[model samples]
Target chain A: MTAAIELNAVEKRFGNVGIIRDLNLSVAQGERHAIIGPNGAGKSTTFNLISGHIRPSSGEVRLNGDVISGLGPFEINRRGLSRSFQVTNVFSRMSVWENVRCAVLWATGHRYAFWKNVDSLPEVRERTSQILDDIHLTHRRDVPAGLLTYAEQRELEIGITIAGGANVVLLDEPTAGMSHAETDRAVALIRRLTEGKTLVIVEHDMSVVFGLADRISVLVYGHIIASGTPEEIRRDPKVKEAYLGEEAH
Target chain B: MNATTTSASNISGKSAGDSLRFYGVWLVGIATLILLPMIFSSGGSLTSFSLIGIAIVFALSYNILLGQTGLLSFGHAVHYGLGGFAACHVMNAVVSHGWPVPLPFIPLFGGLGGLAFAMIIGWVMTKRAGTVFSMISLGIAELVASSSLILRSVFGGESGISTDRTALPKMFGWTFGPQIQVYYLIAFWLVISAIAMYALTRTPLGRISNAVRDNPERVQFIGYDPHVVRYIAFCFAGFFAGVAGGLAAINFEIANAAYLGAIQSGLVLFSTFIGGVAFFFGPILGAILVTYLQLGLTSVTGVWQLYFGIIFIGIVMLSPGGIAGLIMMHRPLARAGTLQTVIPSYVVAAVPTLALACGVILTIESIARTHSGQSSPINLFGVAFTPASPMTWASAAILIVVGFFVARLSWRRVADAWDRAATIARDRGYLA
Candidate 1:
């Protein structure tokens, strides 16, 4: 079976400096994969390259064995890949329900429909409500996404990322500012929501990475140093020296 | 099981009530439109009402761009003007060819005209939003406005194209020669267009448009091209703008270069912004106030446009949400029954506010009249005063100095009262 997400020799350069160089990463279908790296490891850049936010300077990204490089973000999205920003990026002015519904609209095949009322669409309403419930935000459905608590907004971010029912999901530092209890809740939410789907998460938290990822990849500088199961990755000396360091022991 | 069933039934009951209130408001609006002419039977008032209706449509269409899509367009009048010209031509052709097309159908043709131009232009303009979109729209506005003067045969040069509305085939035996008949015709379109625009806001496209407005990048990741959403909104705005333009053409019996001018574009922008861009009914309120002010102020002062500029600036700085926003700000207090606390403070503030306004008006009128070298006495609040009088200047200065100081003090009290009322409202769970 083809990898769900494949970045083959993907190189990204910003002006004179190289951000990502000769990066080769493969995430298999139905696997919860984590890319753990220190600051400036080009983890977010890799997410951008794969999601088509910024084009790779060289090489190609593949989704389900099909080359998706050079496609616009929406085009890439339509091919069943969705992503969330490291920052809590959402339609801040729109209500929680609206933010989730917006993600669900295109996936449900209601493209640019001006004739039918959105509230009357049962499938959309059901799906939106289900996601809101899953994210434990049903009570805050009427509140603007911007007004939500930090952890709640992070949950909303994950809800939106998975609301489209995309097969491939990429979350960038979803629990960056979250407390321990909040991070546990978020990890549980991510695990539940991304079940049976391909997840490629870039995270800094070692506990989330070890607990949630089916497989782990440690990135150093602009290249992947190791890829294996969490046990094998914990024992990899290079990963320990370069990234894991004192935390690994 | 019992709880779920009761909740379901309650949901259905609430929606039914909501729909009832929805239709009730629309019914009341239609009734008001129908009875307005009966109440104000004079020709001048009828004419004013007709202008207000056209302006309402135009401003609402402009809001679809500015408010709904967050596309700030400077040349929206191009669509309006082109639509007017198209309708004028169609009416003339129908009259001369003896076609049986009725007058009510002309606005549809105008809408088609606007749509055609929008589809062509919007494809290019909506490629990049923000500063690029705004600049391109400005350029296009200048281009179209200049073309109106150059394209003499089509635009009718300086005089513009005129048609006889009475010559069109009759609807219900109303030839539409009388101003009242035209007023009714405009009212009908206004209601239809308003309903359609409001309905657009509830649709999937409408919801996505708001998302695009808030964050275009996020919209793209959700499998939507923000550019396409903006283009769709632009086309709709153009269509409705065309309808407004067609109505204006029929009302005036003329379509001129001025219809496509920058001033006309500015007027729509002014009305929509002042009314508030946040709500559907904002532009309507704005259009009514602007139309009334345009008519009322033109007769009273030569510097009316200057006053419009000042009012627009004031709304932008003080109340960015416009009139609708201002009114809605009091909703929580009203719902919580805490509004009474703020009312006394508001009343106290009103005295100095009125004095300050009068003082500013007096100062402006005096300066404008004197600068223009017009010897005519300026009539303000039914009191005629010589522009050259020292007493007029002194009184204006006194009012400004005193009113400014007093108004500041009173406004502080109003703010204090508002905070107390808002706190009460929050405690009552009526405020977020």
Candidate 2:
């Protein structure tokens, strides 16, 4: 069977600088994959490549069997792919409910429904609330996303990412600034919400990665040096020497 | 699924109430429109109200692009002018060629004309957002406005094309010849377009456009193309602007080169922005206030545009949301029952502010009189004073100095009171 997400020799360059070079990654269906690396390892660039936010300089990115390299971000999203930005990118002006409802509205095929009141849509509103509950942001439903605390905003971002019910979810540093307790809750929420869906997460926390990821990929300098099961990656001498050794964690 | 449906029913019931409130507002608005002419039946006031109606439509249309889609268009007047010209041609056709069209329906043709212009240019214009889009629109506005002068056949050269609005088939035995009839017609279209635009804001497309405004990349990730959303919004904005233009055509019975001028475009932008783009009724308030000021100030002062500049600057600096925002800022205080606490502070601030404003106005007027070599006695708000008098200069200087200090002190008191009220409001959960 075709991999859920496949990046074959994907090369991304900005000006004369190569951000992601000759990278190959395959995430199996329903797999929990983590891309862990130091700052500027092109992990987020890889997410952009797969999500079609930016076109790769060369090679192909495929969701299932179809190439999604040249598609626009929305088109890719429409094809069962969704992503969250590293920075909490929720709609600040809109209420949290409105933000989640927007995603659910589009996903439920309410693209240009001008005649009907969107808030009255049964399916869209229900799914939106459910996601709000899933993210534990139900209490702050009426509050504008911008006014939410950073942690709550990050949670809302995840809620929006999954609200559309896309089978493939890309989360960039979901627990980047979370306290130890918040990170644990976030990992649990991610695992719970992304159940039965393919998750490709870019994270810095090794403990969270080891706890959540079924498979781990170590990327450095625009290249993936290792991709293996958590045990395989932990035992690999190359990963320890190249990255894990540099950081005590 | 069962639980979801139950909650859905609950929401539907709630929304049913919302719809009632929505229609109730429209009813009250239309009722006020019907009663307004009865209360202010003077021909000049009717004409002013009609102008306000047209401006309400125009400013709302501008809001769709600037406020909703965050596309600051500088050339929106192209569509408005084109639509007006088209409506004029239609009216002329009705009269000169006996085309047999009703005058009330001319705005639809105007809308079509506007939509056509938008369709032709929207794809290119909507490609870029923010500054570049604004610049391109400005360039297009300049291009079309200048061309209106060259293409005298359509734009009627400098004087513009004119037609008799009464030439059209009578509606319900009423020829739209009377100012009141035209006023009612504009009021009718204003209600319809306003409702339509407001309904659009509740639509999925409208929500996405708002999302596109706040965070475009986020909009894309959520499976909506920002460009497409912006383009659709631009087209809708153009269509409504055209409707306003059509009303103008029928109201004035003419479409001139000035209709498509940069000044016209700038006027719409100013009125819409001054109204506050964030709120739906902001533009309506803006159009009314701006039109009133335009008519009221021009009659009183030669430097009315200067006053407009000052008001616009004040709105930008003090209340960025404009008049609507200023009104909204009071909501928390009102809700927390602390409005009375702030009223005295406002009075305190207003006194000095009024004094400073008067002093400045006097200084400016005197300086202008002296510069123009016209030392004739100037009417200072009903009192005549010779600009050459030493006492007038001395009083003006004293007022400025005293007003400055007093205004600063009073404004500080107002700010302190506002902060206290806001704190209470926040504690009461009346503020966001």
On lDDT, the leading prediction is 1
**Per-residue lDDT value at A18 in model 2:** 95
- After best superposition, candidate 1 residue B109: deviation in angstroms? 1.1
In angstroms, the error of model 2 at B32 is 1.5
> Candidate 2 residues B155-177, lDDT tens each?
98889999888878888998988
- lDDT of model 2 at position B91: 84
- A1-249 in candidate 2: lDDT tens per residue? 789999999998899999999999999999999998878888888998999889999999999989999999999999999999999898888878878888898889998666787767888878988998999998887777777999999999999999999999999999999999999999999999999999999999889999999999999999999999999999999999988998865
**DockQ of candidate 1 against the true complex:** 0.55
Error of 2 at A20 (Å): 1.6
List residue ranges in candidate 2 displaced over 4 A.
Answer: B1-23, B373-377
* lDDT (tens digit, per residue) of candidate 1 on B276-379: 88878889999999999999988877998999999999999999888877887887799999999999999999999888988898888888889999868877
Instruction: Give me the displacement of residue B278 in model 2, in angstroms.
Output: 0.9
DockQ of each: 0.55, 0.53
Which of the CAPRI classes, incorrect, acceptable, medium or high, describes model 1? medium
